[model samples]
Target: MDVRLARKYTVKLSFEEIRLPPFEDILILGKKCPQGRIGVFRSFDFLVPNEFESYEVEDKSVEAVFINKRVLKKINNEKIIEILQERVFPYVSESEIIKVDFKMTIFYDFIEGEL
Candidate 1:
């Protein structure tokens, strides 16, 4: 059996006046900072192309909506929180983070059927 694991990190920012753009939109802005790289995924709509063809190439434009999104690597959670607290806290006044979600996906192939 062979298996693979994948993980993705996403952060959602909400403001009182929709001041903060959607994650995808932010990624398109191409904002640069010492923090990280930020990018947005334009279309969430899904469609099946050439459903009858097994090897047909599908052409679609998944526009990079916002390029302002930033990414920080090799940093601990505590440090991230600290940085957010210091830099973001000042700008956001009594703001609320509606949700924080994490997802992990696993792909596996069985050499001889079900394990």
Candidate 2:
């Protein structure tokens, strides 16, 4: 009888700065996401107090949307909801949590004595 043993191991390591709240401007939680809206909200509230706002969506795929309050300042709530439903909801699933890097650009025109 002969016995032979061989073992090989490969390891990879990477490191990056930890991002607070682990997300950017938006966090979209599906209906069946692992973490409920309240838990997620609490975590965000603790990390960045009064910075994020959560809202429930009426769509079947999306459970809720957590948007930065600063974003709300730039865009209205109704418009935000409308954009999510029209663009993002169709790609989301009931059991998924999605992180969105939202960006807003504003334009303004001013003329002297045009009030």
Candidate 3:
């Protein structure tokens, strides 16, 4: 699966807020600031990104810059659930989660063999 940084939200989490029980990968969709690359991180080890802010899709700043951005070539929804909860859903209301799901474009991880 391949997901683009369609729209982002004001949702943000700090290392303090990020819990660690059944730890798993988080679905990060956007450009990593400073270095600048459309990528994803399974774990947040002091990684901050730019673009993709605001669950209200249109409110995000992705499209024009990262349009057709290439992300991880492989993905597992079941795995990123924890990341979404701690980092994503917390900022938005319980009701808005469903709406966020509708707008995203799912992408997958990339490997060197194909290239």
- Model 2 residue pairs with clashes: none
lDDT of 2: 0.87
Worst 10 residues of 2 by lDDT: 1-10
- lDDT tens digits, residue span 27-103, model 1: 21112222222211212112222111111111121111211112222333344345434544334322221111212
Q: How would you encode candidate 2's per-residue C-alpha lDDT over 1-115 as one tens digit per residue?
A: 3344565679999999987988878889999998888989888878998988889988888889999888898998889889888888899999999888889898879756755
In angstroms, how far off is 48's CA in candidate 3? 32
Error of 2 at 4 (Å): 11
52-87 in candidate 3: lDDT tens per residue? 222212223221112111222243333334445455
Off by over 4 Å in 1: 1-21, 24-73, 95-115
- Which lDDT values do the candidates have, in the order given? 0.26, 0.87, 0.31
Q: What's the CA RMSD for each of the models?
A: 24.8, 3.2, 20.8
lDDT of model number 1: 0.26
Q: Which candidate number maximizes lDDT?
A: 2
Best candidate (score: TM-score): 2
Candidate 2 residue runs with Cα over 4 Å from true position: 1-11, 113-115
Candidate 3 lDDT score at position 85: 47
Ordered by TM-score, highest first, the candidates read 2, 1, 3
